[model samples]
Target: MLLGFQDRLFGLTGSGISVESGLATFRGAEGLWNGYRLEDVATPEAWDADPELVWRFYSMRRRETMAVQPNAAHRTLAAFEKRLGDRFYLCTQNVDDLHERAGSQRLHHMHGTLFQSRCVLCGRTFADSGLYERPDSMPKCSNCGGVVRPQIV
Candidate 1:
């Protein structure tokens, strides 16, 4: 009897919960990610061959991420957390901060984050400085000249 009650008392959510936060759900139809397949921008080989190109791609994504806002789904989850107390857990696959902005105190980003950048040489991750409007020739890693890459999965 206790086990049955516990099973019905827990709340489980997947990427769908975050989809309501105005974030692009990758691997879905009309996803914001396209062009230059993952092979060209998401692998060790790609980083080794062309770090600048990879940085550029991630930088563009960061800029776009900054422009979006949390949607109703994100807001609803936050509200649920308020009511569920400690029984609610949110797991998001998206890198955007929509869930955070939506007031979700208990959440996890399994993939990674889009608003943060990591040093290619030192592997140090830090928040983006909101300095993405410079020319292509500009924007080098603050810690190292190795170029900053988005900390995405």
Candidate 2:
């Protein structure tokens, strides 16, 4: 549908965006590196092996992300998108929604976002931002009564 545009501007972002906003990177010595392993929290197999642990990690991430704001780089990309309109597109590897917070309307998250979840049963995805401190408090899918897992990729 965007084939009509003669000019296009594409921006790609990664962990730098999160780091610039004070959201610790997983590989950082001060962050998840201290307590978790990617094999235990980042893979689908990891999620299947220990859902509660994965949930805890992701919940902590959501809380941390909610506390921070987008950095200058995010704002710059957003501004460029605003000026260029539909001619601009942004693809981000970070799961956080800093790009959206910075006013970027045309963007895609290459990695799944921390704010969305999908049912384990039917794969119906939906918006969710609340933190679950325990397995009992975890969200249940309204569509099929299955456990809703985070969309983190």
Weakest ten-residue segment in model 1 by summed lDDT: 1-10
> For every model shown, what is its TM-score relative to the native structure?
0.70, 0.90
Across 1-153, the per-residue lDDT of candidate 1 in tens digits comes to 123223323344555655554444554563324567656866678877876666666666666667777777778778777666676677777777777888987887777777777776789888773544344754567777766666777
Indicate which candidate wins on lDDT: 2
Q: Which whole-number lDDT from 0 to 100 does residue 61 have in model 1?
A: 61
Candidate 1's C-alpha runs over 4 A off are: 1-23, 28-34, 129-147
User: Residue 103 in model 1: shift from native, Å?
Assistant: 0.9
Model 2 scores a C-alpha lDDT of: 0.85
Superposed model 2: Cα runs more than 4 Å off = 1-7, 30-34
